[model samples]
Target: MTKLKTDRREVPVDEPLDAEVVSFRAAFDQRSPIDQIVREGARRMLQSAIDAEVDDFIARHAHRTDEQGRRLVVRNGHLPEREILTGAGRIPVTQGRVRDNDPDHSRRVTFAPTLRDAGRYRT
Candidate 1:
């Protein structure tokens, strides 16, 4: 699959819960079509949310930079794709990555610490 460029400005506000009957093409996977749609949508949602969070981090640190004048925190594209097991199913996702120009910072510069292996915890 190709890398998708999502516009961070396109985050939706509040939408009505859509439970209407929808059609989905059957595939080898046990997940129903709706499940697949949900999985993909969830993946995109998660990616977008993280992207926004990263943007906030970058903004907060924008005033700080290395000696070369490069931003302290910058968007580093994304990490490799990984599967996140959810109640819906195992959905493949590629999370956004950030480059920490300042190595002295205490934070690890990742969603990992905030997300903290979501699959292992039962929330």
Candidate 2:
């Protein structure tokens, strides 16, 4: 007796389900696997860069508290009233108590910058 060879057309290859493979292909085509990977990587890189910048800023301006447990960062001066201009309009500024100052009378009082100041101290 001779061994018989199976027809190539009757043999099944190692392939995924047609529906599953079609869905996968569609998803990849919609977003492109390469593009999705690149976008995720870029997003992570940008987030890391932003985190590093924030960390550096915080390290440079670490806050300290006084015996009274007040924020060491200057917030206001001894001035009674001051004029401040904002996007809306000009507004009156009320000064906060002086926390620390030079022994010498330099007449320059540093005020704590607020969100309004955009991170710039007022003098």
Candidate 3:
């Protein structure tokens, strides 16, 4: 029986080693624990910013109410989750949904994240 060095491990000569395993070892970049932490932090920060934007929008429309005093602008729910490719990696985000219940279509207000407003993503 004979042994050969594959990367840093010893493999028996009888067993075949994958060519990809040896070739891609230096090219492939494995995400470290720190990278995972950074990705999670970015995700949380983005989510917080989006939620704050929605809150501010609702506050601004607080004056607009119906005859029964119900607010015209309110949070309906979250939008479909989408993944954004960022420097940190792919981050899944769910933006808040704002529905303007105003009877006049001309005076309707649509809420969108500042990131989208920056022209980074299409609404």
Candidate 4:
């Protein structure tokens, strides 16, 4: 019998490495821990900014009822919900309902999340 030598240059047979590579890339690049934290912070900051702007706008335009049973200047027919910072903390709020035929349109109905329960609500 003659002795034969086998080549050792062939690749090993196993699952393709491409899938593992792809999964690693996705896990590291797409949803990294740092990325998630930064995203959450940015979202909170944006929400705060929006809430402040809405409150300021409402304060500037809103009017109070008068002694003569007439408002000096009605801004909005519908009382808008405002994101308010109270002694307790920031809160998501909805204003009381107003007459349907009221003339003022400045009072906008705003929807904002409270600091305590901000992240729970999603669009």
Highest TM-score model number: 3
Greater-lDDT candidate between 1 and 4: 1
lDDT of 1 at 12: 62
Candidate 1 structure quality by residue, lDDT tens digits, 23-120: 23223336677877898898787667656766777787788777888877788897777676777676666656778767686853543424426563
RMSD after Cα superposition, model 4 = 15.2
lDDT of 2 by residue, 8-90 (tens): 65536675468977998787557566766765665455435434544444344445445676544443334454444433223
Cα lDDT computed for each candidate against the true fold: 0.66, 0.47, 0.83, 0.49
Q: In model 3, which residue pairs have backbone atoms overlapping below 3 Å?
A: none
Ranking by TM-score: 3, 1, 4, 2
Per-candidate TM-score against the hidden true structure? 0.56, 0.32, 0.73, 0.38
Q: Cα deviation in Å at residue 37, candidate 3? A: 0.2
Whose lDDT is higher: candidate 2's or candidate 4's?
4
Model 3 scores worst on lDDT over the 10 consecutive residues at 114-123
Error of 3 at 102 (Å): 0.8
Q: Which is superior by TM-score, 1 or 4?
A: 1
| C-alpha lDDT (0 to 100) for residue 110 of candidate 2 | 47
Can you write out model 4's per-residue Cα lDDT over 78-119, one digit (the tens) per residue?
Answer: 345444453323344443322322346574343432442533
Give every collision pair in model 4: 75-106
| Predicted model with the maximum lDDT | 3
Cα deviation at 28, candidate 2, in Å, is 11
Count of backbone clashes, every candidate in sequence: 0, 2, 0, 1
Report the C-alpha displacement of residue 87, candidate 3, in angstroms.
Answer: 1.1
